[model samples]
Target: MKDDVDTIALVVVLVLFAAVTVLGFKAARWSRGSSLASLDEWGLGGRRFGTWVTWFLLGGDLYTAYTFIAVPAVLFASGAQGFFAVPYTIIVYPLVFLFLPRLWSVSHRRGYVTPADFVRGRFGSRALALAIALTGILATMPYIALQLVGIQAVFEVMGLGGSSNILVADAPLFLAFAILAAYTYSSGLRAPALIAFVKDALIYLVIAVAIIYIPTKLGGWTGIFDAAEKKLTALDGAAGNPADFSFAGVGQAWPYATLALGSAMALFMYPHAITAVLSSKNRSVPRRNAAILPAYSFLLALLALLGFMAIAVGVNPVGLNGKPNAQLSIPLLFETMFPSWFAGVAFAAVAIGALVPAAIMSIAAANLWSRNVYKAFLRPGASHADEAKQSKVVSLLVKFGALLFVLGLDKSYAINLQLLGGIWILQTFPAIVFGLYTRWFHRWALFAGWAVGMIYGTWTAYNIPNPASGAQHFGGSTAAIPLLGEKGYVAFTAWVLNVVVTVVLTLVFRAFKVAEGHDETSPDDYHADAGEPGVRDVATPGAAGKAGAAAEA
Candidate 1:
């Protein structure tokens, strides 16, 4: 994968990188509000984004560099298992459609900045909120690292990195991460919000071209799939395992279905996903986006096909270690298949795609730490300005933390951790989503459930060895279901236990007459909309019944 640097592509990449750096800074004043010294403004884009802005924001940031690099790489590596991402993206919207508007409305009316904020309000449990926040930040770290891994893949293809020294190999990525930290520090959520527009356009443009033009060279979709299938079946036959390379076979079906289902449940639970949702101008904005956001699904399906195209084109990329690296599949595919300048544009798209989501993810994680961890424990009386300052600083640290994961661990480790993160995050669904409609589950019970789920999920993931590398733990996302003797997503299995524990604990707590704590929200809060009379800037937390406070005041 290392060669003479494509001078033309390198220049294009740097030029585009500099261009987005400017946008990230200019976004600070794009939609001027009273100030940017608070979580509402600094971390959630002042909650002023309308439908189209929200659309681009979610579109670019949500799909992420992982979608661009990892999904295709997985397809290139294993065939059908990677296609799980496609159906999961489709399944996620309808699941979100049912509950996200309710979340938006409640958060819009109540000044909630994170999912943990909602949990705190609904359950009146600081411990539960802390668990939710910690899980989000923990789950988010590897996901962010994967984005850097995307940029690293692009750099490797361009011959910018492939050194024996860690610092030398990662210097270009370090520069990209530094620029991202700077803009996010200065502009906060606005940085990613503005940059997302360019990211979306470039990704669509690059994919549109690659799908049409590259397939023509490879003799079209028929040849691509035929080549992919032939290669996959031959490998499976060699191993004495007959998986249908064209589709997930009988043995693979349960894991595929559960992966899709569990992943769909976990997608919106990430702090970054909630940050985008909470940034919308109003409740209607989220609902509208939910219905329309699936447009990205069509794009995702097309993106996954690039994997087969990689297989068809006979792409065989090696990593800096000179080992066959499936993660390099797409980037090297572009480098090999396209002209230098066009390949440069494609690389820029992948690199910028990583930046947008990485910024958002860092912001989301920092906000979680500030609101739930810092303010909740260390400085309970902190001001909005103080919280904003803390989050700005923490966001920088979070990116570096991701850099640590990228530099220190395996590339596949980031991917597996993301899957594990999904398992961890799904545990919060019962606490946050259920509390939206009813307070039937006691707060302590929810906390206990989360603990059980987190511990169980982590243990199960730790035991599933990677068959290829022979790593003894965290190798894959799936495990066997209880009593079923079949593999399903560990996250879903953990979630099932999480719910059962929560239900049983709730009954026991009720029987023993344990206090249910307090609920700050009334029924109206979940259905309230923007500009409703006396709706305070719900992005900021204050007062006993702040949800009903007037914005104009």
Candidate 2:
């Protein structure tokens, strides 16, 4: 059971890691903006990224190391249910295509830094905007933590995490994080955007090698699938468990379909996703990226097959702490099958994947804190430079907070909390996504719906027990809907309730003649493009200087 550290692989990973760190620090000057003192330059990369940069940045920001690790890990554990990710990601692009252009347009038109900024402009309700901002920051914290888990999985597989002393074992991880924090503080979003090109190149190279080489070594895809079927079917239909080794069992379709749909809906609702979209130079960037991003979905489908490949290879990886670690499946699979040097490449891919998204999520969360919480509540008269400085400080805090999640919580609990985050973030859909199209929902009603959905989603997610983990609550993301007689994703069910409540309350509020908040956005703003006068004007350096002066005046 003792795994030896491959010195060659370790050295290779270290070299690549060092190279990325250097690139991250230098990224502050990559785009060469006039200044990095404003949120536009530091947080959103000056909102002038071209199509290719947008593709790599959004891909690295969204696919994430957590996606690379967790998707295959789930497939290794649960069989076909894990393939839900493939469909979810496939459907997500089309869903975003329907609304993101509008969001990008309006955001660019008004110089909004976060989705909460859009919400405030759209509804003119500070309380509602605060709710959206808090939900974003809260949901994003666990997501950033999961990226660390992705990195830790690689460390454990490479024999860097087997130490008995906590300090000795985690020292490497903390060092990697410190490097990530330093570069992010120096370069902001540009760090990740630049590093993403290298990170993604390595990932594609690793995944391409894995799909072609591993299957041949395992007796081809047919042999691999047969071995997986043999192993998984033996465990099928255990008491109180859904059937394994099949597409899905009876009554399982609802959960599977709903999980896919709900996740697709929630995908772009995340602030980081919005941040990636808004950072683009024009509406066409997101529209074009949406069409091309599904190329990653094809890669993901290939990656999911690695879970079955793990079964065929008899790979059972234990965590550094000696607990069973499903997340380590792919990393250990590479170690077992590939040579020392190539295994290092695969491990580095996962580790760097973690760094890319962690930087973006922290930056997005920091933007939320600065624009909605600090500037609105604590410093309404703050200048642009003041906001940027505060965000940099908050970004460091956010990274360390994610580090706490990795060090303080159990890995299984951390994964469950991430799933819980999906549920919590999905509740914001009513206000953000629906608001993009209409102002019919009363602002107070949307807030009320958000509260109800948050309460319901959290309670349901907390109460579901994981029979395998032996935990009493917070075990999974799927639950039975009351009176529906079917199990479904908790987030989608809560969303249904959220909409219903919003509809009901909107009518009641209208009948009572309650005041609706002013809408700061004009109808034309939704369709405005980079060619529009307002967008062109805001893109000017002089306009930014004037705005800063006016704020100070």
Candidate 3:
């Protein structure tokens, strides 16, 4: 690929980044609350964002840079199997429809910031909540790392940076993340909620242009698919052909379907996704987003085609020391096709896509720590001011931790950790999702199920191997169990194991007449917000409250 370090396009991207960074900090005053004193205000934008803000926030939250670059990269590498991302996204809305409202209602009524908050409150088990929190934060770190990888691609293609130099290449990555961290700490969820509009608009423009322009340049979709099919079918003569690129077969279809379903189930469970969910002013916003967000899925269908288009157009990645670097496939395509200026805009969009989500994830992780660990274990009597102070500090630390992931981990390995994230996060489904509808399962049993599922999923994922890919641990999720040789999707299968363990143990404990934990919430509590009676141990007494409130008004 021809390289230009000082192109006007690259300059535009840097300028846009600087603009968004300024905009991010400016959000501190956009919807300033009276005080940032509670989890409601600090963790969830005071749970008051309207429908439009929620839509942009969730859009930015879900459609990540990983989705932008990697989905097509996977298609470029493995053919039709990678297209499963489309169907899974399509399926996720109906799935969330069944349970997310309940989660929102329950969490809102009880002032819960994290899913772990609900878990602890519902099951009355701090241990179970801790497990949920840890899983959420761990799963999110690799995802954050992948976002940096996305930004790095734009920089690399522009000839400004690469991963070769730790400080030289990564300084910009750190600067971008540092800006995100500072704003999220200052403005809470509102920073990203506000910035998401700009991010999503840029992404939609880039993707829309690329979808129309690229296909036309490559002789349309029919030509692209045909060319891709042929190229992928041709095997390497040097390496013995073990993996087949043929799109048809039960072996292929089953894994594709299962992976899609597993991914959809795991998507909303990520703390970042739910953080966006809880930020909505009303429960209906999420349901509406779930129904309408599939419009982006339509966009995703277009994005996935780029992978096939790469093959049709003969867009080969630049080889690194004679070995193909699959990660560069999309970057090389952009470099080859897009004009310097539009290409720079596209690069800025991808970089911004990474930034918005990284900030949200860091804040989500910090909320988990402040509420569950820092306040719960370390300082039970901490004031609201102290809690807010702690969360802001923790947010910055979390960003640095994610920066470490980008610098220290291999790009491919970082992506695999994200896959492992899906597996680990899905383990929380049985406890968090199921508990929303029923409290029938024993709290202790839920903890036990979590422990077993985490162990099984981690152990099974660690043992997967692909010789052609040279991926030993956490390669692709599979049905085959290690040592035992029993087959199942690690996430869905482990979830079943988790549910079974919880149910059976719940029955046993019930038969023994175990003493259940107290439920601090009432039915009305689910509908309660800040001003409601007993919403947070606050009392707004009758006559004095009414007369005083009216006079102040």
Q: Which has the greatest lDDT?
A: 1
Write down the TM-score of every candidate.
0.95, 0.95, 0.90
Instruction: Supply the global lDDT for candidate 3.
Output: 0.76
lDDT accuracy of residue 291 in candidate 3: 84
Least well predicted 10-residue stretch by lDDT in candidate 1: 544-553
lDDT of 2 at 144: 88
Off by over 4 Å in 2: 237-246, 408-410, 413-417, 536-553
How does each model score on lDDT?
0.86, 0.85, 0.76
Over 4 Å off, model 1: 243-246, 538-553
Q: Write the per-residue lDDT of candidate 2 for residues 320-376, one digit (tens) a residue.
A: 677787888888899999999999999999999989989999999999999999999
Residues 1-553, candidate 3: write the lDDT tens digits: 4444847777889889888878887766555456666666677776666667777888898888767777877788777777888999999999998787777777777778899999888878888888998898888887887887787766766765544655776666766777777788887776787788899999899888988898788777788888877777674223443345445333566567667898899999999999999877666777888888998899888777777877776766653223355666776677677988888888888889888988888888888888888888899998877888888998888777777767664454234546667888998998888877777889888888888888988888878765545766566677664455555468777777788898899999999989768666556655554444544421222324332232122
| lDDT of candidate 1 at residue 400, scale 0 to 100 | 86
Cα error, residue 464 of model 3, in Å, equals: 2.9
lDDT of 2 at 141: 80
Ordered list by lDDT, greatest first: 1, 2, 3
Better of 2 and 3 by lDDT: 2
CA displacement after TM-score superposition, residue 412 of candidate 2 (Å): 3.9
